[model samples]
Target chain A: MAFATIRDVAQKAGVSITAVSQILHGKGRFSDETKALVRKTVDELGYVPDSRAQGIRLSESRTVGLLVPDIRNPFFADLVSSMEEQLYEKGYSTLIGTSAEDVQRQDAFITTLLGQRIDGAIVVPEGADSPGIRSLIDRDLPLVFVDRTVEGLDTVPSVVSDPYPGIESAVDTLRQLGHRRVGFVAHSSLGSVNVNERETAFRAIAGELLGEDGAVVVDCDNSSRSRKDALMALLAEDATAMLCAYSPDAIALIGLLHDRGMDVGEDLSVVSFDDIDAFRLMSPQVAIISQQTADMGRQGVEMLLARIGAKRKRRAENRRIPTVFVQRGSVGVAPQAR
Target chain B: MAFATIRDVAQKAGVSITAVSQILHGKGRFSDETKALVRKTVDELGYVPDSRAQGIRLSESRTVGLLVPDIRNPFFADLVSSMEEQLYEKGYSTLIGTSAEDVQRQDAFITTLLGQRIDGAIVVPEGADSPGIRSLIDRDLPLVFVDRTVEGLDTVPSVVSDPYPGIESAVDTLRQLGHRRVGFVAHSSLGSVNVNERETAFRAIAGELLGEDGAVVVDCDNSSRSRKDALMALLAEDATAMLCAYSPDAIALIGLLHDRGMDVGEDLSVVSFDDIDAFRLMSPQVAIISQQTADMGRQGVEMLLARIGAKRKRRAENRRIPTVFVQRGSVGVAPQAR
Candidate 1:
């Protein structure tokens, strides 16, 4: 329900807007009779001075804007929840804008956040180059980029997960188990720069392990109608092991295997990136390249707050949080035990 | 990133605030030099007129507030996502407030929303008796309750899934499969009235199908450390078929069974309420009672929009969405085969 503004209270009190504003602020001169009538109208209308309205006059709303990729993904959902908890403790409320991994929507939301006069912003950028984001930087608005950062905008503070350790460990473990022909199933569609980072690391490491043939990249989007066919193609390959580069791809592959009656360990070895609850609960619980999502969220807030408070333009924080491999039962000694 | 406020432009232009406001609004008398200076300053400062700040004076902010129990729950996450998509299509942005299923948090969020001047609100109430909610009703706020309703506030609009059909089907299916002893595992600690509703329906229907002795109700919360003990107790019973009253209980049971090397459909028959992604991917997919979560969200937005545009007060919407049972592989012929 909308609260009444000073104008509404003034109209109800049959007084000038100034009279109502003055009485409400407990300032300016007014007759006792008039003040009494205004006070009564205030009580009757339940008109408390809207602090948000006051915030517009002053430039401090204590509201921060958060741009996430998507909420359906539990990883991002958990990130939002954790960040909101931290922000709430610091007397700030989060206004969420989900990009859904679309660059246009990301730019539009950036425009909206700027027009809303947000005190600060934290964006999980869709792509490196967006005019709206550039405008934010030009204005010297306190901002923190998380999950991924735009290239060449190295001066902007950001927090991104280092995908190397997890990818490295996964490669080492599979190699140790004699899986030379390991296929890397990558979802190249989601616009997160982390996808590119993982792919780079994967190709480099898989190249080192099994040469160019084994550093195979399967570009698929989880939403694609042909994803199942692509999975089948990957399955028919001579590769002894398959690593799902993302959760959605992992889920899609798992479902396809379920449909084909092919067991994970016996028929194929598999792993995925980004740990999700469902991944752990699967029969042969999937191994994953895990990110510290909560820490990423918490640090993003703390860094943004630091940016917001600093009088001098502080040096940008381009920090890399580490990822690790959480191996369950999914990856097995290669099916062809070569 | 934050944008420069009106004050910033005023200060930068070396002019009085009123002079800048008048020039920007194109109102009041101002010298041409003053107007030109303000315009140039505005361009330099990138001062886009903040419509949201303007919304402070107007009752309609083109913003709707949505309160959910928790965002970490994929169920609620999906709900928020679907609702946001609909609201976005209608050119309205949603302000999200997750209560985290805490009554205190719910109340604080309620207070925050009320002060926000949101045009309308859709709440998944934590509990019914918050004075803040009652105040929204008293103030004639266009509000819709989703997922749960207050005990006496039957006059308020609401949307909830009818748990009866799903419960009834589970009992009937298990009975037809030759299970004379069916145990029902329930979780009532979520503080939603639907918990009570499901429990009552389960006991009555399961009693009718499998006798009073077979209508075993094991009550526990998902977060409780004793959920395993409760499950062990349920196992100790002579029940051949089990019906999990909620998703968390179903998940916990599945993990426990997997850990113990007890396969579903081999050691026991199981069915759960709410269709989650992981359920279908399990070795023997768990059967479930699935709710139209997306519909619940879409309808909540439509109903709130209707309430907002209503010329006169209308009877509250006590709408009930139907739930259907999705039969997966988890359920099989009772071990005793009569």
Candidate 2:
């Protein structure tokens, strides 16, 4: 059986092909009588307009691409879920690609999305500046950055969390709880803006509370084993409490502490950023700087929609969402020197 | 800056517009020098090929639509992530829509995907014989079903889990633990193929072991409050142990049991399906019937790719991935005379 095209429907409905196309694409003007006739003919003939044909006629692909660092991370999952919800409401569909923190994979995904002629892209860049991403930007594609910001890029709309306040709050809480020698376990250096803000706030607060040499910062590669080693090194310095940069690293450190037979929040206090789902169900609750993942996702869709609507006119803007510190069982007074 | 059209590029490169278009679209053969000249001109002019024009000329959208029930569910997230991984490798972009388990929403998503002129679709239908899905099948659209199959839809390829052997193994394990009265709690009725298969297998095994009267089935709506009520009712019926049909239900039931001063695995044996991420980290590990979530995602992509490649020639087939029961601490003998 042959499928009815716009031409067939137009002939059946006794209208011009452009009229049928206009009605199907929801663009241009047509009489109510003609519209109803076209609609009726489309239904009766079971005509499903070829999307490829419509896309060609409109010069718009009507699709957006999203690149995430990882999907297994609940934070990213929640973000993607929220974004999908918002985008679905607006008649836009998202093509999500997980880079898994690999720069080459991220480049490959961007290239694929570009080749597909996606209307725009929202990416969580693997690092500060990606050459492929730069090329896409240079090609004048509409792009939005989410969660993490890429340095050396100008005037791209981005949605990120302010990590400073939360870090400062955690440090203040630690100081008030009589922690003098504090350590920090960071997965990476001050490359990511969020991480930099967190580190700056942590150091300033620690220095203000306990002189110049009171704070110890251990920078490790973003891996579970590296974090475990960093935590052990920090613990060896007689640092009574440690602040973890993120949830995955915090979880790994907790397991390491458990293996060493040291009780979390009792022998050594701990706090982490990013309150992942499993943390709530763990035996020893880890204090978390909760980035509003759902809000970030919702805002991302809003920002992208705004760009899509005003692509020809509007200038780019960066929006920062705030983070809150949730005090749980992982944080407490450091054990007194015996 | 004025955008360079195919005419401009062709004029500059001293070639026909059709030749330039062919080279840009990766079609029709061209000489090495001519191809290199056109490529250089396109790069110098920073010309972005209008996908709409290409679509009109070639009749291929280069897009695939994916419809999932819930993006929040880790199982679906894993499925989607893997599909994206494979599709990106094959130079196809995915447009994802979530139905949130609402049939109306599901229908709307299908209509939208069709409207966008997606080259093909992979859907996890909310239920069997949905009219919206049936319409796609009637149109002979390239389609594949994942996770759940719609009954009466014989012409679409489907990827689903085989629960019979998994349920049999789960029951056999309970039987070895001296459980005489075993209860099963599922999210829905026997209408869903996955739930129905597990329920049927459980009843057959229970009937053979402890007579027909010994088996109990509780149909709980996919909500925490409803699951709590259903679990309470099941526990009050003198059942020795219970099997939860899904992970979310298990998480809720375990928390409820703990709140009610009942000890899992000791006072009341419990087994759940879907070994979610948090389950492994939670203390007093929950016994789980683990589906190959990542495998499901990867295999679904392979099946969808095959359907896409053989759209004009292939017949429909149903592919089943096996499930395994991962024994943890949640199963044990019934408390003596309690």
Q: Determine the backbone clash count of candidate 2.
A: 2
Error at A69, model 1, angstroms: 2.5
- Tens-place lDDT digits, model 2, residues A43-120: 666454553432321345566778888776778878887887777677666666678688877876665455453567
Stretches of candidate 1 exceeding 4 Å from the true structure: A1-57, A107-117, A127-140, A151-155, A189-192, A209-240, A255-269, A331-338, B1-57, B115-117, B131-139, B189-192, B220-240, B258-267, B333-338
Q: Best candidate, lDDT-wise?
A: 1
Assess chain B of each prediction and give its TM-score: 0.78, 0.73
Superposed on all Cα atoms, the candidates' RMSDs to the truth, in angstroms, are 13.5, 15.7
The deviation in Å at residue A188 for candidate 1 is: 3.0
lDDT of 1 by residue, A91-165 (tens): 886777787777877776665455454578898888667876775675567889988888889889999899888
What is the Cα-based lDDT of residue A289 in candidate 1? Answer: 84
lDDT of 2: 0.74
**Least accurate stretch of 10 residues (summed lDDT) in model 2 chain A?**
A50-59
